[model samples]
Target: MAALEISKATRRIASTYPSLVLFQLARFFLVLATEMQAVAVGWQVYEITKRPLDLGLVGLAQFLPGIFLFLVSGHAADRYPRRTLLVLCYCGFTLCSGSLLFLTLRGLHSVYPIFAVTVLLGVVRSFNGPVSRAFLPQLVSGKDFQTAVAWYSIFIQSAVILGPSLGGLVYAAFRGPAAVYTLSFIAAALGAMSTVAIKAQSNPRLGEPMSWKTMLAGFHYIRSERLILGSISLDLFAVLLGGAVALLPVYAREILKTGPWGLGILRSAPAAGAATMAALIAHKPLGHRTGSTMLWCVAGFGAATIVFGLSRSLTISLIALLLVGATDMVSVIVRQLFIQVSTPDEMRGRVNAVDMIFVGASNELGQFESGLTAHWFGIVPAVVLGGLGTLAVTALWSWYFPELRKTEKLHSPAP
Candidate 1:
């Protein structure tokens, strides 16, 4: 009887969210390709220059395009066919991976070309981020949206857990970067094909004109909504301060004295933790006190980052990174839920675009920040201080955004 009940529930969810399943499968390949490229790029650049700032430059190169295109990209998502747009974007990614493969084949030593390729990839992501997110609401019913988000995260986290490790193994097995880049190109091509298979959904906002006002509307909506503003800002500042990912190569090479394989493991540790947490959430969704849970989880992320910064032992560092990933996953889910539930369907593209920019800042820009700080004051001190700063920001945000802190549930308020 129990087994039958479980089977029935599974069938119900599967029937209700078929598009989501396709989306996740496509995203899995996309993320896998991207992560493989990341591992290869990080290792190659660090090997050539041996400078931490250049590592940060990798992130900055990827982020700069979004700064310039945030408004335009958001508007495009609203006005364009999202599935077709996504197909094009993944095709662009395949080109980037192919270019990287060519560079590696030519015994390229200069980092400039690599940086340029990353910039082009960033341009693709600028358009990809908003459209990909805005397309979500079209995939599932309103009642199933939150569960879909959880499952969406599970797919992403699973990819994150697998991609880096696979990349590292391929690099090691072939004893070169070419193999990694080759695999990445293949994965990206598969992603594009999978996206092409998804059934098309009509864009309701297709008739909306590209005006200065329309481009700026997303920013205005977020600013007016305290919950949205607070949730997005909290993630921005916290992750901005706590971002230690860009420095992983340094830690793996110098601090932990590990090779590329170890670096891959280190890179995947957080995702492994996050994937575990995401699977749990998908099985049993968060019901109450979500706001406070988000706050605490972010705080835990900071604390874990601090531990990672201070650790010399590989075992200890992995554990710390695992905690960092798990805590950050909770914050990610909660923040995404807030953004999805609160915004109307028409505004999702632009709003998610704005949110993507914030995410870009906290990730790529934050990498630059970490690199700059590490250059000024050694790696350990820089990371430790950043973790401490994350803690401080959490405290300040909790006090300033009492509404976010006091919130009890994930349900959308009446329109």
Candidate 2:
């Protein structure tokens, strides 16, 4: 009887598990693939051009279109079927991968075409971000959203850690860029398939016209949300200045004195740390005094960034990066939970777009800053200075968002 009951439970879970859950997992794999590809691309471009500025330009190329199209992307997400939109977005990304695969296969060493592809990918990502964010609520109830989101973060960070490490290893082992591109294309194709299989009940809006006016409303609403603005700003500035991921290649080659395997370890350290912490948070939500927690997490992240920048030993650097990832994960969970709980279903898409813009700007823009600063002060000093800047930004934000500092409770009821 017990064995029969166990089997029955397994069958029930299999039958009831939302397809969106699987879709999210597949999305994670593609993100992992993309991050891995990015490391390959950045390293390849830097090797060819021998210019730090070239690395910064790669991020700039992606961010330029992202900023221009983000608002419209959000509006479209709000007005359309999110699952279909996500499928289309993955399709576009796959095409970008196809182009890169072609270039690598043909031994094209020119940097311009790579930069162009990066920009094109960014354009597609702008739409993709909003759609993915808005699609989540349709899969689960509000009470489960927090838990679900925590799992989502785990998937994302895990991929981020795994992808670059794998990419570095695969590139080094194969000694050819084509293999990396091929892997990326395969992952992207899988992501599209996952997206296609995602099930959702769509409320189709009939004959709703899109306009700049609706887009402006999203911007206006975002401006009025203090917690949302504060949380996003904290992450933006802190990550922008404290970002150390972009400097991995330099660290791997120079300070670390290790090969591609070492590079993978350095890259994966933070994600590993984040995944561990995310698992803990999923079981126990950060209750009450969330605001103060966010501040301290950002502070810890900044401190870790400084330590990472200053560390000459690979062990020390890995430890510092791990701390940074763990701390940053706390801030991320807080912000995402706050945003999802506060946002009405009608506004989720545009609000998500606003959030994505802030996220994209901080990361890619931070990479540009790191690359440019590295060019000027050399890599170590540049990373150190960025860490200090992050600390300063955290201090300033503490005073600026008093309400956020005092936010003591989130009112989600039991499912």
Quick one: best TM-score, which candidate? 1
Model 2 TM-score is 0.86
Q: Which 10 consecutive positions of candidate 1 have the poorest summed lDDT?
A: 1-10
Candidate 1 positional error at 123, Å: 1.2
Off by over 4 Å in 1: 1-12, 42-56, 102-113, 200-203, 247-263, 310-313, 371-381, 412-415
Give a tens-digit lDDT track for model 1, residues 309-348.
Answer: 9999999999999999889989998888898889887788
Q: For residues 89-179, could you state the per-residue lDDT of candidate 2 as single tens digits?
A: 9998889889999887778768998998999998998898888877876776655566667678878987887887788788889986678
Cα deviation in Å at residue 248, candidate 2? Answer: 4.5
Error of 2 at 204 (Å): 6.2
lDDT of each: 0.87, 0.81
What is the lDDT for 148 in model 2? Answer: 67
